[model samples]
Target: MTLPTPMPDTPHTSAAPFASPSAAHAPTTLRAWVCHDYGGAEVLELQTRPGPTPGPRDVLVRVLAASVSSADVRIRTQNLPRGFGLLGRLAFGLARPRQPVLGTDVAGVVEAVGRDVQGFQPGDAVLGVAGVAMGCHAEYCVLPATKPLVHKPARLSFVEAASLPFGGLAALHFLNKAQVRAGERVLVIGASGAVGSAMVQLARHRGALVTGVCSAGNVALVLALGAHDVVDYTAQDFTQTAQRWDVIADTVGASSFATCLASLNEHGRYLSVAGSLMELLARPRGTRRSIGGPAPERVQDLQMLVDLARAGALQPVVDRTYPFTDLPAAHAYVETGRKRGAVVVVAWPEP
Candidate 1:
């Protein structure tokens, strides 16, 4: 459960790029998971590719762990919100992925850095989301020096750190936007899921009265994550409960947005992850609003999670870890909609 601490000694940063890996470990090419076409996990094929070289402002990370998030699944299956399909195709690819790799969140060691890079070194241990330029499913990937990358918390493993960025950043963004504060009643649907789990912990840390809605099987998991109360959706409908909340976060879009909005107290916040076509039509135009958008990726936001982890307030839950070669299987597992927190794919060095 605990991860080794990175050496606190200030790194020797420079405008000049770090040199290539020593001859002992140097290799001209590497293996990576490439998504040639998008439909399902079967489309992700293992292929050989030229190794990546850091740009003038990039750091090449030797990925140790990469997590398959809801974003990855949606993008792969074209399960996007209405009117976003064309945008997705244009940004990603018409038939296959533009970058070909699927992972966005990763925890790894910096293998090299570019001339203009600073605040990191060739061997710094770090974690972050790669955003739109995602390619973390490979053994190596590049991250902008100014992106969400941050030092891995001392007590978090590569797998744990890898799991935090996408979910943590999302929950933090929506919860903060909702003006979460002390003593407010907060309810998180899909509370045992990636974003949902993070919301539960963050709301609790912010001194809110936290209630989580999950299946009966995951009731204990949500409660163990600091949710003050847990609702088993399989046994009862959370929206039908008599209690009202100051904030209702539908981390997963499965719940009816309108029904949730009606359940909030006057002037309460409704934070939906995205605009489901049905939700778009029912959106409020007044004080009782429904806000949904992409979760922003920023280094400062990712660092906040590290600070919380150090303070013992945030801990990323890892549901399962698969070998890098088993990414397709991992994807299949995630598609089943049964994972507790996150499903991670760990890299194995090539022979």
Candidate 2:
């Protein structure tokens, strides 16, 4: 896990504004927003709790930022796609939250590491997916060092870093499932949303001719984000388009499997993050498959995201930023399903 590194007297220079909670009246136990039961955002309650310490292969991170994604919403609402209720309850909780604090996307600094850990030291800025352990919405959280943890790229702010893990990983997974290749034709439905937006950029980065489907208002925005062509779903139906795609990735399940099938060229891939029953039934159609059952969590993929961001090929889309304490409003806004991209929560306020 954590490679051996010397502890620094100061946090990374850029992270100075995101001062650790331990700086002021540092308490042994940290304040955490906890979820005891599954319900709406109202189920969340802010309470002081004992701080988490690193395990032998884990690192304790002072959370600087976290993201409110569809997974978090699903966990809170107990709505785990169709037919996944039992499995979801098993992984999450039967009647209550298995992980109490439901946030997976994390951008933070190493506060401490376990005895067996290396490659990290106090004040090292880092970012990664916390997975189902879901303890990111707090002043401090412990993360497995073996996962996709990496040093935060110098180019992105904490909010931007927070935005990448969930959406970026999902998009990367589905895109790879589609096997996007150079000179291929890629179409991304729900292009204005988080995963779809990342899919557009990654497909383009792979040298595909990218087309994006979104609302009329987001047409220019999608185009600016590197979509070769923009389809306004409000005014037109993409299923009726003349052009065919080599890979059809639907992030919001806005298009049916039949529509995606008819729109795809022979042997093309149809990927969906949110799949309908019809799409699930269409899985045997040879080219159709539903993605996002599990997210992509490979460290190499995380490194690719960092490299793309550093090279200015991929940019994290942050629709809005909410203070860590305003999670209720953040959840309420995400429920509206109108966010342009990712919504971020700043766990640690800027000093």
Candidate 3:
């Protein structure tokens, strides 16, 4: 696949350079999961495709690990807005995924760098957004140096690093939007899920006392992730409790706006990482009216997450790892909505 022309190099900022990996023989052809229709994970098929050529400022990464998220599932099922449908089909290919690949959050070693690229060479260990472009569920995925790509933390393995980006970014964004502070009480709904689990830790790292809502099975897990308290959603509704929270981070969108609002302290923020098609479509109108609501803030949040990871204040809670060939099963497991943490897809053959 051919990438867009690279962007001009800007003055080197204070940001740290990506860590270069050990060089290895590069492959010309790569295996990837491709999809022709909008449906379940079954629609995804394995195929060989021409490896992507990096434009100036781009790095071609040999994917060692990737992850499946709810966003990928939505795209696969055609459950997003009309624009997503139209643009996804047009940009990806109508009637099927234009990129055909599914996994997004990626962690890998760089295979080659574009001519104009700086800070990254032929071999670099990195993690970043896959955007809506090249599918990361393959042997290689390309990302611009200017994108959210950052050096992988030395403490994390490729699979662990791959699981962090999307959920970490989303959780960080919502927590910041909430402006949680020390001693403040924060409630995280769906706290055992990928993004929810991240919120549990990030909020705690910010010094806020966090209460996580999840099933009984995951209460212990949420607590282990740094939540000060855990509310079992199956046994009781958190909103009915006497405790008033300064912030409510709803990752599942499982509760109504009214319920969330009812639980919040005065002038408290209610942030939702997951939203319906109607909510996304109505977002612009809400913004135009100066009414604050859930918004999908991406790139900037991703950068913040990288900082936290580098600082050792945040870490991914990866619940399961699947071989690349079992991507279908991974997708199916994610759809169950019971996953305790991020589901990782490891591209490298398991030793």
TM-score of each: 0.90, 0.89, 0.83
Best-first order by lDDT: 1, 2, 3
Q: How many residue pairs clash in each candidate at the backbone level?
A: 1, 5, 4
lDDT of 1 at 139: 83
lDDT of 2 by residue, 1-351 (tens): 011212211232365433342323233788788887888888999888876655677777778778888888888887766667787799888989878987887887777767677787667889977877778888877888667888898777777888887878889988877678999999899898888889888999999999999998888778888999988888888778788888888888667666667788878888867875446556546744444456657888888888898889888888877778888778878888888778877744442
Candidate 3: tens digits of C-alpha lDDT, residues 162-271:
77876787787677666679988988888988888888889999899999999888887888889998888889988787888877777887764455666777766666
The global C-alpha lDDT for each of the candidates, from Candidate 1 onward, is 0.80, 0.78, 0.71
RMSD of 3: 8.3
Evaluate residue 103 in candidate 2 and report its C-alpha lDDT on the 0 to 100 scale: 87
Deviating ranges (above 4 Å) for candidate 1: 1-27, 277-286
User: In angstroms, how far off is 243's CA in candidate 3?
Assistant: 1.9
Q: What is the lDDT of residue 48 in candidate 3?
A: 86
Candidate 2: what lDDT? 0.78
- Candidate 1: residue pairs that collide: 15-115
Give the Cα-based TM-score of candidate 2 against the true structure. Answer: 0.89
**How close is each model in CA RMSD to the real structure?**
5.1, 6.2, 8.3
Angstrom error at residue 151, model 3? 1.2
